[model samples]
Target chain A: MAQSSYGTENNNFGPGVAYSQLDAALLVYQEAGGRVSATEPTLDLSIHGADGRVLTGGLVADAVSGATPNGAVPSTVSQNFVTPLKARGSTASVTGASGGSTIIHLPPTPGQLATAALGRQYTVAPNTLPVDKGFRDHRGAITLGWSQPLGAISDVGFGGGFSRETDYQAISANAHIAQNLNSANTTVSLAVNSEFDSSSPFGGIPTPLTVMNAQWKTQASRNKSQLGFVLGVTQILSRRWLTQLNYSFDRQSGYQNDPYRVISVVDPSSGQPTSTLYESRPDNRQSQSVFWDNKLDLDPFVTDLALRYYKDSWGISSKTAELSERINFGTAFYLEPNARWYQQSAANFFHYYLVGGQPNPAFASSDTRLGSFTALTYGAKLGFALNGRSEVYVKGEYYQQTGNGHPADAIGQLRQQNLFAGTKAAMVFLGYSWDFH
Target chain B: MRRPLLIILMAGASISIAGCTAIGPKPWEKDLMARHEMLVDAYPLLIAADEHIYFSKEASSGGRGFAGGGCGCN
Candidate 1:
């Protein structure tokens, strides 16, 4: 049987044979309506020692580009927005076509003869979503882990990872321990993880709830820290049934706002945007969740079911359920079909837009992710066993989200607009795994 | 919040009771349980990737395991 330990799965091989497995996969994701697209390639290698020791390493790279919403409501009239240029003092001339936007020299601050900086401006057509067409970034990440059996304990492991992007960096570390009991039918595990992140956007951090402007702000960067733990239990319910339960707790502190996101301040009666302000969120957050999963073997097929409940200090609550069934065809191939349902309530401070005359809340965001919504995902995987030690698989999934587009409290033209036109996305993955001695 | 906590406690208690019933499989009868498809985390990497995508797009994350890494995507 597979050892129920972190980073030690699929280690049941013949005695005295040292083996290593390599996994490579490519993921392609695209959102409908040209919002965002990403391609990621990942490679992982794990080496298993003869004496129950394992070392694993992985590398991943992502390229993302495309338009992304700026958290502004659709408007009847075209709107123009401006942001600081990529570089501070570059003399490069403005281009007519720059990612569907234009770069223009900003007028000098009063009493100056020359312009101080360049700003990029994008225009949104009437009744269209305001998106930043220059949204693009590349990221690379690496992870390393090691695990080994320690005397009476099933496994103990510690791992660390680092990922870097154009504007962000993250460093994380984790440790876990597992114990087997009841004649190896039950396994209990505990894992703790910590992460530190630095966000240094190209244009500097903006003051929360301040007017969105082309002028650069003084705050250069911000950092966030997170700590979390998970406790899990795995049990062999029967010869053909296995079950697992997990409870997790997480806490975060420091900057939590998306520096680039904004919220529209609209006229109270007409629902027309009068100004835009940077979004804001609480600096500290705490969350907890429970997950239960089961796998049942039924001769030619296997069934997997999982359920999760999550709650957070931000007044956001969520539930998720997923099911998958794998059908085996002889010994060389298998097909798995899966579906997932998820729903989440809005954060207490989520608003489609702030009213111009109302007092600003201490914490507010127009990001749809903080709003109530339901999502469905359907997918299937096809796997081909090339040999006893190698396999190839391809999977595709479709995801759709829906929410109340028009609230009863919506004012004037806002009632006619789809405030929550949720997202639709498609993803595909191709993967290969090989084990060698 | 209280209701969900109550449900979680009840579920945990039920599972604990089931574990104490001694209805688990014997070591000799673990062949079926040993199959790859029967493992609790049959596709760890795929699940990890899925979780990453969800973390970027959703408001809630991390129940099946500790969230190992942080990103500024949200």
Candidate 2:
């Protein structure tokens, strides 16, 4: 990675308001349209038996370039946050499953699915986060799931999976029960999920809210646990219309901070960042979300609409809306167009920099993700089926993110610059699947 | 908040229980409902990959089901 010497030109770095040449250079660089891009290629394969049993697998490779978030504030004078970076990686997985009335001999109608799967993935995401940009991580996981019928009108299912990564490990389990009433015209479901995680960033952890120590001493790993529950209902409104509503609540405790992130220390009045310190976060978080999805079948055209509302304990809240339409060209080919809009509020303790004079808050971070932002995504998919047994599809999407750079408290030259100008990226996918007896 | 969530769940349950079969498709007219595309998650793998991408880039997660693999991304 080639880093320009933008910081070396400034020497009179001190407290209070001071001249900040770095900010001017940064605004110019951003105005010149410099950004990052990422690519992901994936291949999916599936085989099916006449008895409702299925086996599936896939491989995904990713190539990412341009600057990701570095926790440090963007140079007020030059291009710092948009670092020159690159990374490439891949993941592979396999799974076997059974569904519909595979177990019950009677009632050929669809029941549910039972599945078991094992997967492994390895990735080398280099030049991303500051901590050992050459970070290499791999993970392995296995899951088993089963759903059984309760008489003729209800069903119950449970599943669990354990995954271990080079530095992070997680174990999760879930159970759900559904009841079909009014002659199966309506279905109600309640489910619960729990996860236990152990994470240890590479190069060891650092003391929170402290200046970067050159020694980079090692610290013990941390643990976290999460529990969530969901309630959902689906209704067959008409012959061509269906709708679903779901509400979910989640609580997570223990280590909730990213070990690699840091907070920037800046001049109290000028808002010029002088140095960086490790970031810290609260140990617990709770959140809840509500989602609604609707689908309409209009002969050769199918349309889907979804909306979601979410809020968390960290004072972060978000809303998401998505729409997609599928145009079928007979039974052999189809084209689906999709669009999504998302907006979020910043965390309560989020800040671009910690002022030199003010007392440090209990927790603070400069990570861009913790700031208020809006994102828009547009994509489309085209699929082709070969003789009804095999299918191939291609999908492409473009995403743009914009942050609220100016806050009421922004000081000095900082008020003139768009610290969080914006980020743009695109992704493409090509996949194929086959079903055989 | 808890009371509101409980009320919403109860309302949904009540609606599901009160609905009648007369407004639904007949048993023999269930062909369209049984189609693969009619399933909520028609393309599981693609959806999974899409979820992973969003999870890594955004701060919010889990509108679908849980039990997903964890990552160091966020």
Candidate 1, residues B1-74, lDDT tens digits: the string is 55666577458746754664495887789888767668676667788788988888889899888753466788
Residue A101 of candidate 2: its Cα lDDT?
8
DockQ by candidate, in order:
0.63, 0.31
lDDT of 2 by residue, A98-181 (tens): 211011111111221122212111111322222222333455555555555556537677776676666677777888888887
Model 1: which docking level applies? Answer: medium
- Native contact recovery (fnat) for each candidate is 0.65, 0.32
Q: Is the docking of candidate 2 incorrect, acceptable, medium or high quality?
A: acceptable
- Kindly report the interface RMSD of candidate 2, rounded to 1 decimal: 7.6
Candidate 1 regions with alpha-carbon error over 4 angstroms: A1-17, A89-91, A109-115, B1-14, B17-21
- The TM-scores, one per candidate, come to 0.94, 0.76
